[model samples]
Target: NPLMQPNAIEKISYGIDEAVKATGLGRTFLYERMASGELKSIKVGGRRLIRVADLMDFLQNAANQRIS
Candidate 1:
C-alpha cells in the first residue's frame, strides 16, 4: 500500500523539525548524530532534506544494533 501513499517527491524536502517529529528524536540528539556523521542529510537552499529512504535506512541500521 506504500504506492498508494503520496510520493516523496511531492513532499519536496524534509526538514529537521519534520524528521524530529517523524522519529520522535530530540533536537539535540538528532543534531549530535548529524554532527558526528552518523546520519546523512541533504541541503537544499536553506533547508535540510532527509529522504524517506535515508531515514528508513537509518532506522533499520539502528534497529539492527543490540542494546544489552
Candidate 2:
C-alpha cells in the first residue's frame, strides 16, 4: 500500500534532502524557508517532507517573475 500510495496525488511526500537539492538551496537556507512557511512541508512520523507538485509550482512561479 505504501508503494501504491505514492502514485496518487494525495499521497505524495518528499524527503528534506531531496527537497533541498530540488530547490538548489543550502541546509540553513532550506530550513529558514521552511520556518518562514515560504516553502510548504508536511510532518510524517517525526520527519518533514515536501510535495513534489508544490515544489514544481514554486519553480514555475520563480521562472515567471520578470526582471526589473
Candidate 3:
C-alpha cells in the first residue's frame, strides 16, 4: 500500500494535505514546523505549497539531527 500511494511528482510542489500524508505528521505539527521554520513553504496567490526538494531536504536534515 505504501508503494501504491501517489507522490504527486507531476508538480514541483504539494499542498498542505499532501504534505501531511507524505510526512505522516499531524496537521497541527506540520503547521507548527512551518511556523518555526523547520519546514519551508511558499504561498502562491492564496494557497501554500511545499517544494519537493524542500521536503527531501527536511527529511534529510531530520535524519541528520537524529544521527547527531
Candidate 4:
C-alpha cells in the first residue's frame, strides 16, 4: 500500500498525539497510564514522548495479561 509505504523511516519516540493515533488509545487514557506508571514516558523540553520499544512492550504486556 502506497499510503503505508510513504513513511519508511520508523519513529523512535512519539509525542502524545502521535502515540494516541498509533495506538488507537484515548488521550486521557494514555495520560492515566503514564501517571500510574503502567506506560512509561519522558518529557523533553516540555514535550512528553514515549519510546517505540516501550509502547510495544506495554501492548505486549497488556495482551499477556488478557491471556492469563
Across 1-68, the per-residue lDDT of candidate 4 in tens digits comes to: 54779967768999999999999999999999999999999999999999999999999999999999
After superposing candidate 4, which stretches have Cα over 4 Å from the reference? 1-7
Per-residue lDDT of model 2, residues 1-68, tens digit only = 55777775553657888777666877787678779877777888898888888777766766777542
Q: Rate the local accuracy (lDDT) of all candidates.
A: 0.78, 0.73, 0.88, 0.95
What TM-score do all the candidates reach, one by one?
0.73, 0.64, 0.80, 0.87
Backbone clashes (count) for model 1? 0
Candidate 2: lDDT of 27?
Answer: 73
**Candidate 3 to truth, TM:** 0.80
lDDT, residue 67, candidate 2: 40
Q: Indicate whether candidate 2 or candidate 4 has the larger TM-score.
A: 4
Q: What is the lDDT of residue 22 in candidate 1?
A: 85
How far residue 17's Cα lies from its native spot in candidate 1, in Å, is 0.4
The alpha-carbon root-mean-square deviation between model 1 and the true structure, to one decimal in Å, is 3.3
Pairwise lDDT winner, candidates 2 and 4: 4
TM-score of predicted structure 4: 0.87
**Candidate 3: residue 41 Cα off by (Å):** 0.4
Q: Order of all candidates by lDDT, from best down to worst?
A: 4, 3, 1, 2
